[model samples]
Target: MRLTVLGCSGSVTGPDSPASGYLVTAPDAPPLVVDFGGGVLGALQRHANPNDVTVLLSHLHADHCLDVPGLLVWRRYGPEPAAERALLYGPEDAALRLGTASAEVGGECDDVSDTLEVRGWVDREPVKFGELSVTPFKVFHPPQSYGLRVVDSAGAVLAYSGDTGACSAVEELAQGADVFLCEASWTHDPGNRPVGVHLSGTEAGEVARRAGVGQLLLTHIPPWTSREDVLAEARAAFDGPVRAVNASESFDVVKSGSAVRRQTS
Candidate 1:
């Protein structure tokens, strides 16, 4: 299994990176694109065909799903006609919200049913995608949100915390994962942050430590926060390796003994 960082900026697009997007691919299977945020469709096109992948959104935040309309545009009017409707998984309102956003007329919801087969994810139930099994766990966040645990046929686990503050559900989703792609959107200073919307570096580290994950790939960092400071804070709480992931960076999932880790790609 391979994991690709398409974008990692938090909240909004930054000078160097887009908002939040990721890609997970397995041999001979269709790639799964997670969170197609702003500027992601263009970046994703550089790595894989837009029409040949499945999309999963952690939430409907603009930074997490705004580029979905771009994808719909490509699939609907690109050079070659779409072979079939691609799968789209997210919250119950995904189709309505995204369809409306992609509509040509003002206040009209485009019938996206022609472009993507939309499905709402039920928390804790594992959905099969070729050789991969994805289980989503409800997490603490505005509106609706989930963290995911993806297991490939090889048993290599990849867990993503999505966007959430510290919660037991986040830790449960990440339990024993090989690579925990967690969001660390703020510094550790409580005096400078708000509550219940996002996780600080220290809180993200605690989740990694409690979950006993093999490696921590911190992501969703905003431009204003210092990467060095966040990484240092995470490192203090997690004994294992913790690295801040950047756009276009890739990791090859590998297993050793009973542990799973990624070789830098």
Candidate 2:
């Protein structure tokens, strides 16, 4: 399985990158996209086909899921055939959140939702889409959020912590994962409260350390926060392989025994 970083910024689009979005692809199935943040459409255009993608939203935050209308427009007007539609999975209110935005863009919500099959998650239950199996666990975030563990048939697992604070649920989801795509939206200072919703770099690294993940890819950094600072903070806590993912970067996961090799691209 291959995991691609479509966007890796936090709160808003960074000067050099977009908000949070990722793509996970296996050999036999189409790519599964996680989050559809602000700049994800452009990233998808450069890396993959929007029509053949399946989106999994982490939450309804603008930075996490505001590009659905643009993607739908691209699928409708682009060279791709209308028959090619994306499958969308998210929280229970995903359709409502996206439908409202699509309507403002002069796009029909029903048509968009019909073209994209929307599935709502219930904690811990496994959902299947082709060869990919997704299990969602509740995370620490206001208004509800989820941390997803995606696994292929070969038992390769990639866990992603959607914008969330340090929580046991995230640790549970990330346990023994090949790659942990976690959010590091704040600095190292514990006293500096960042909206009380997101995790700092140290916290993210701690989660990775405790989960015993093969590799930790820190993401969701805000434009104001320097990448160097985040990396340094994470390194202080996690001795394992940890790096910050860039836009368009890809990580290949190879199943080896009980663990997997997470190769960066």
Candidate 3:
């Protein structure tokens, strides 16, 4: 399976990168986009057709899914409009929230049912897309959130920690994954940071170490956070390779310690 980093900035759009978004694709399986945050729709055009891919949102935070409305626009009026409604899998409130965002009038949610086939993600239930099986694990985040575990036909696993804090469920979702796409939104500061909302770099590393994942690909680092410090924290905890992913970077998921070979596109 191929994984692409559409954007990796945390919380908000940074000067260099947009907010959170990712692309995962494999042969025979339809292209899957993990999130459609700010600036992602434009970025996706470079790699895949927005009208053809299935969208899986980890949460409804603006940085993680605000651009989904843009997708609705493209699918409804683009030069070549999609033949069918776009498939979207997210939280139970996804349709209501996204529909609200797409609303044209005041206080009235747009009937997005026509433009998108909104579906809710059930915890631990595997959703199949030809060669790939995606499972969502409940996470310790606001209203509702989940980490996605994707396994290919060949057993290559790509586990995305979505936007989560330290929790056993996160580790379970990442257990034995070939690539652990975790979020380290902050440097290690337990005393000041809020609890059960986001993870520090040290915590991310701890999760990777505890899960025994093959490779640690850190993401969701905010612009204000120190990347080098986060990297140092993760490397100190995880003996395996740990990389802070950047926008446009791509990886080939493999079942080895040295898995996820990076390529700049």
lDDT of each: 0.90, 0.84, 0.94
The ten-residue window of minimal lDDT in model 2 covers 256-265
**Candidate 1 ranges beyond 4 A from true positions:** 257-265
What is the lDDT, from 0 to 100, of the residue 24 in candidate 3?
96
Pairs in clash, predicted candidate 2: none
What RMSD does each model have against the real structure? Answer: 1.6, 2.5, 0.7
Report, for all candidates in order, the number of backbone clashes: 0, 0, 0
lDDT of 2 by residue, 69-100 (tens): 78878877777555855678889988877887
Evaluate model 3: give its TM-score: 0.99
lDDT for model 3, on a 0 to 1 scale? Answer: 0.94
Give model 1's TM-score versus the native structure. 0.96
Please give the distance, in angstroms, between residue 202's alpha carbon in candidate 2 and its true position after superposition. 1.0
Q: Which stretches of candidate 3 lie over 4 Å from their true place?
A: none
Residue-level lDDT of model 1, residues 30-99, one tens digit each, is: 8999999999998898889998989999999999999999998899899987899999999989999998
Evaluated with lDDT, which candidate comes out highest?
3
